[model samples]
Target: MRMEQLASRLTLKRAGNLVCSVCWRRYKRSSIVHQWSRYWITTRAQSPSSRPSSSLKGPAALGTQPTTPPITKKQFPSQLELRAVQRLDVLLEDCQEFLQKEVVPTEDTILDALKTCRKLSEYFRSVKDQPALSTIKPGGEAGNLLFLDADPADTQTASSRTLTPIAVGRMASSIAEEAMDKIAETIKRIAVDKNVYITSKVLQEVVDILCLLNRPESLAYIFILYSSKPVPKPNQRPLKYTKANPDRITAAIPLKVAERALDAAIKVQNLPLCLDIIEHTVSTKAYKRAKTLRGAFLPAVAVAMTPGAAYIVASRLAEMQEAMSTSMMTVIGTAGIITYIGTTSTLGFIAVATANDQMQRVTWQAGIHLRERLVREDERAFTDKVACAWGFADPRRRGEEEGPDWEALKELCGIRGMVLDNVELMEGME
Candidate 1:
């Protein structure tokens, strides 16, 4: 009879928990809850009390403090731990749109987003009783601050923004590495899941982050992320015309100045700015058709030019100028374009020749020194066939410092191009 009662109660409880039926059945003597309680009490009567003592209440639960719920893979979110991921998410979406519908970018603009990432790390570390910081990853500087001010995806004009597709990819990589678990999970899903469509902006941000990582996998991921199309960062600073420079107000800049700025920007390994300076030098001269280049780069030129090399190169340049002029006159017979080439031909040739020679020697010397510098710093065991540019350029190639000489080479390349234009030009002539 006891077993029968227990079985009936169990059946009633199961039925009650499953659903409340509206069937026309007779009501039992006891309710499901009452039966459950009475049975539970009787079943464990000889055991211990499972219910609380009723003393410790509410927040102050009895028996070993109610421990905070542990973070689970499903429960703990990245946003909670990585605030930077939140900021980066907004930035990445915006940048990816820009890259796809508009401009692909470098990591510059997204750096602010990464700054938040550093904050996330700091916050996370702090929670773990540790301090956090932002460390400059070597060669990761190209897209570092590139994305500070990005333009809308459909915005016209390069001046609208500097965010490039390449940069966007890099930022994504950074988020993947540093963002909290929550944000990272989302980003990874975007990067990998096939069904879900990852936007161009998101992929681009991923590229920016991965490029900074300078890992082959990151690079590969970038390609995979953008497997649909090959994209390049559009021209951002197109055709800007600023006053030549201070100290000299003239119709044009001297050749020396043009070479200097271009060289210095290269030598200091400031290629991010170097290409622009080089373009400016060439364009301003081409359009102005002035006897000299823009003067803005004068001070830098004066500082970098070597007098001894200048003289020899200048002499050679003068001979070439005379020969070209003679040939031009012989063909055109002192007419048309040749007539204009003669306006300040004599003086122009002399100055250009000297500047060219000086530029040549400086480049050679710079190369030798730059190689030494990179070698020392990274301890690169560069073979005769190798010429590594940045620290992360060769992900697989390793090197030991070879002293200050190796480091010097890198510095030279940083501020100066490895090959001189004059030398290349001369080779072309020969």
Candidate 2:
């Protein structure tokens, strides 16, 4: 009977209908506890005590003070800085356009634009590199401000466009008195800071512009800068325009430009500046030796003329003694001395002032120093634009024809006896 009962219990447990007494008791207890927990949670949510703690409030909760967000300082554009960038941009564009067309901007346009550049540069410095600058509008592609890159792809156009605004502006007409200081500053930046190669054309144009502006002193300063290989800062390591400092790096500027610069200096009566330009221009060894020899001009002329004057006076005195009264002799002697002295003095003056044999290959009066240099260098293009500002003869129709008028040049220069002899004229004469 006991075995049968045990077997029946095992079979019931395996058949999945059997539940353990301990498990049934635990289930009843869990159901009651769950009900009670749900009731407590609902009550807690309704009560004000379950609200978020004030101690857990924001950034202040982590032992930190509550603070307002930082204010970003606003940037305002400087009128000067904005104006400078805009003016520079436009001027550069106009220059590039003119270069592309193989033409030049009008004198007025160039002058105004350059003045703007000067003003811009002035303002930039006056502000002491302030960050408050206006944003420049997107224009065409930005160009090289210092120089034009040699583009191999467009060789033909490249040669034509071998110029920059700085180059063009440096050649512009009539800079103002106030803006004069800025010129050296700008050039120093170009020469020292940016350190770009100033082309021959650019330098030639500078000569032309300086002539127009009547800035011979400035021209002399520029000539010195040109003479330097990597141009020095103004007043720093200043190079002397002397034969001792022969230009080994920079290309020699065309003789025509030198002539123009000399003319400008002479017009302003800046003799020292004139001499400096002359010294800087001519570098040949023969000229150097000849310059040294030229120191004897006064002595030579004095020696030659003193005897002639003495002979005339002595001969007059002897003749008067033989042929006239004391009073008449006195008058004749005085007249002869005066005439001889005056004539000799005048001739000596002319020779000293105008002779090419002097230390200065070209004198202030002769105005042919550069031409002489060209001839000595055996430069073939003696009549070219770089040599003289004339074509062989007038190409205009007869009545309207305008050719090289030596008289007009003389009158324009206002020099009493201006002698302009070009290599072409000399060659033709030969």
Local distance difference test, per candidate?
0.33, 0.39
Which tens-of-lDDT digit does each residue in 1-430 have in candidate 2? 9977543332111112331221211221332111110111111122345332431123233343434211100000212222334445555565445434422234454445445454444443333322211221112122222113323321121113222323222212112232333443343333322223344655665565445544557666566566554532323333322232333434455567877877777677554565556556644343344443454567678667765675566665666455667566756665677677778867865665444442211113444454343233312121122213322344232123244553443343234223244333242344
Candidate 1 residue 211 Cα shift, in angstroms, is: 7.2
lDDT for each residue of candidate 1 in 353-394, tens digit (9 for 90 to 100): 334332321233333443233222111211111233323344
Candidate of highest TM-score: 2
Which 10-residue window of candidate 2 scores lowest in summed lDDT? Answer: 32-41
Clashes of 2: 0
Candidate 2 vs. true structure, TM-score:
0.27
What does the lDDT read for residue 78 in candidate 1? Answer: 19
